[model samples]
Target: MKVSSMDESGKYDKANERLAQVKEEVGKVMVGQEDVIEQVLISILCDGNILLESNPGMGKTKMISTISKVLGLEFSRIQNTPDLMPSDITGTHIVDESADTTDFVFQKGPIFANMILADEINRATPKTQSALLEAMQEKQVTVGNNSYSLDDPFFLMATQNPIEQEGTYPLPEAQRDRFMMKVELDYPSLEEENKIVDRFTSELDFEPELENVISRSSLIRLQEFTRKVPIANDLREKAVNIASATREKEELDYGASPRASMNIVLASKARALIEGRNHVSEKDIKEVAKPVLRHRIGLSFQAEKQGMNEDKIIDQIIEQQ
Candidate 1:
């Protein structure tokens, strides 16, 4: 069913209500970082994973919890530690001779949920990190020759401490590329922080209750709509060119993968839906360029020494359009 043909007024009302519902749900637990929450939701609704890089004490955990609650999805959080093992996240097969002598039962891990918050992902070793990354890419975990697919609306929101370097394992380029967006969650404004303080201190330390306005099936439908959303030939080329500039441009050593193009296209569709548009526009592409493309592009040591940043390179590509 077309977005336009399916009860236009009703769909719009529902969409808007869902948007507001998510915002209100997140706002209840979080004092601010509304934009971060919105972007994270966009990624989730688009069936994509997100990488949120911020310092400590940024309420990343609370935000993920609130979103899971509002969406009525099973939520799981894994505190990624250096000593974390693959079996710890992907589960393992242990023969329980005491309970059942003949059968080996599968012990499920935290990745089995619909919504997963990989808190402090950088703290985990790369081997353990790949366990979650594989699930993010395949949406399934394999153990002892058996595979288990994760539930639908399976979303991973990983948080990292950008400032902390001690005993942290930063995500490599290949792993980073899997994420649809690398969102930066900064400190809230002074007014927002003050409100956070007042609310947390005054309230019972519990977030507001959120109504489940959207369903997992409806979310899947929305993702399908995003795939069907029309993109003009020119806009498609623009997206391609923007991706090409990342690798071919002189400032960078490596370019973004085909995954980046996919992200740009899907994220633009999600943006249009949020803005009540049936078709995607270049404006939507431009809006998502930075967050979608920043981490995908790699800078040379010379460029880094020269203080050239990803945003600057993306700005140049945007100016070309």
Candidate 2:
């Protein structure tokens, strides 16, 4: 973790090289969303869930699926809908009949995978959404008095459309807090959009063959190394101060919890490792602040009336710190 020795330095360098390869592999299918890809990688390294916000047809699913393949992790997707039941995602027990006897058997659901893409997550009713709560936080599923452990390196990336609100159930505050970071994917730039169109239209079936850049065990080790990334005492304090400032700000009705503070520091460490750095910096904290605090904090009526948003409030807090 220290990387002071030549062997540790070599491992650190190899990790970054493989991570860059992962981005390159994902970039083949995904047009241009470097920031989005990096955020997802950071969440994975931290072993935390992500809440992704974007409009439809933005390749959110493709991005996640492609990354799963490149990282060599098991991928499963759940298309959330109002009628989707808890059993649909978490599986249910069924009666198994044999020649002489019948017994109940436990079946596994899509949540057993290493990476789960919960598409259009807001479309699911609160009851169905709550079903994911235990799995997301505990990495285990409970079915009929039995608990089953999820695979290693498990994380859920849930997506919601920002343009649509009707007939959609907003994620409750508790569920939203379960996500380590809430990432907003904007529309691609003109150049990127053109590339996207040309890339898909040119071929009858467009599928970019991507290599497995990192294996499951290596990924697990990298996640452990992410935590070992060092940070200066002052930078660590700065991260805490930024989270604490949210509660003190008058423009917000309620601020982020202590969990937010922990996420900021952990995420910063992950970011530093991703950037091929040995230590965390102020820039790392500032870069991750908005995504870490946006969904956790609420704006006051006055702030909302003034057209102020969570990002703006977060920026002010960072400036103060």
Top candidate (TM-score): 2
lDDT of 1 by residue, 132-217 (tens): 87788999998877999998879889999973568888788888998999999888899999998887888675556677867778
Model 1 spans > 4 angstroms off: 1-13, 97-100
What does the lDDT read for residue 304 in candidate 2?
94
Candidate 1 local distance difference test against the native: 0.84
User: Residues 1-321, candidate 2, lDDT per residue (tens digit)?
Assistant: 454687777777887888899999999899899999999999999999999898888989989999999999999999998899999999999888864688889889999999999999999999999999999999999988999999998999998988356778888999988999999999999999999999999999999889999999999999999988888999989998999899999999999998999999999998888898878988999999999999999999999999999999999989887
Local distance difference test, each candidate: 0.84, 0.92
Alpha-carbon lDDT of model 2: 0.92
Q: On a 0 to 100 scale, what is the lDDT of residue 99 in model 1?
A: 61
Work out how many backbone clashes candidate 1 has: 0
Worst 10 residues of 1 by lDDT: 8-17
